[model samples]
Target: MLIHHHKTLCVCDFTTLLELSQPKISRHLAQLREHGIVSDSRKGRWVYYSLNNQLPDWCQRVINETYQASQTELAELLNKSLTSESCCE
Candidate 1:
């Protein structure tokens, strides 16, 4: 999920990237939101999530490092978002 650093992602994006069920994704996202690691905004019927910039510097640094380390996988996951199909309405 750290791959979402500095970017907004819809639940569909996470579902596609993780190949997980919506309920599972929502559960995890709820946990992240609870911990102040991620935040969400409504765009129509969809909600997009991004890393919470207000997080501690150390937390941001860790997310950045993890994102950097997973660049290849992240790129592949991002490519999926370019498709016309997604879990969103």
Candidate 2:
């Protein structure tokens, strides 16, 4: 969903969007960061994550395609993210 929206999101946002705990979200994001799949930036107390633009074209294509294929199921989560307020605020 982050790839689809092309926006940065914080752990709190993922907690809200995915209905998961903050630690779980943070752990997954940390792993993604370690793998170079995502990049993070610290903004005050919040760390926001976005897809790594430096990814190879083939990797980008795969992520884009996966997002496309899952769009139907992800529609609700995407909508929720847009409409919901970030806890960071």
Candidate 3:
């Protein structure tokens, strides 16, 4: 789940929340763009993204609820695992 709230966010915001480098966040955002999960538009030098309204309700729900930082300590664990997996790929 992505932590993207209702606001249209910049890449820097994504990096800060994901605790990842700007380039890393950019790559993931690119992948998400490819899947049509997030749509981007450029305003000057910045790019903003938000969940597409065209998606199924379930997808929007996931993105909406994803912002509530996971509680189980499993979130940090899973984040580590995900980082490792992405780094290796």
Top lDDT prediction, candidate number: 2
Tens-digit per-residue lDDT, 1-89, candidate 3: 44343256677655645677989888988998999888888877778787766889987776556555554543553454233223212
If scored against the real structure, what TM-score would every candidate get? 0.80, 0.88, 0.63
Provide the clashing-pair count of each candidate structure.
0, 0, 0
Report lDDT per candidate. Answer: 0.77, 0.81, 0.65
Model 3 alpha-carbon drift over 4 Å, by segment: 1-3, 65-89
Ranking by lDDT: 2, 1, 3
lDDT tens digits, residue span 22-73, model 2: 9998898889999999998988988889999899999999988898888788
Model 2 regions more than 4 Å off? none
Weakest ten-residue segment in model 3 by summed lDDT: 80-89
Model 3 CA lDDT for position 35: 97
How high is the lDDT of residue 43 in model 3? Answer: 76
Better by TM-score, candidate 3 or 1: 1
- The window of 10 residues in a row where model 1 has the poorest summed lDDT is 1-10
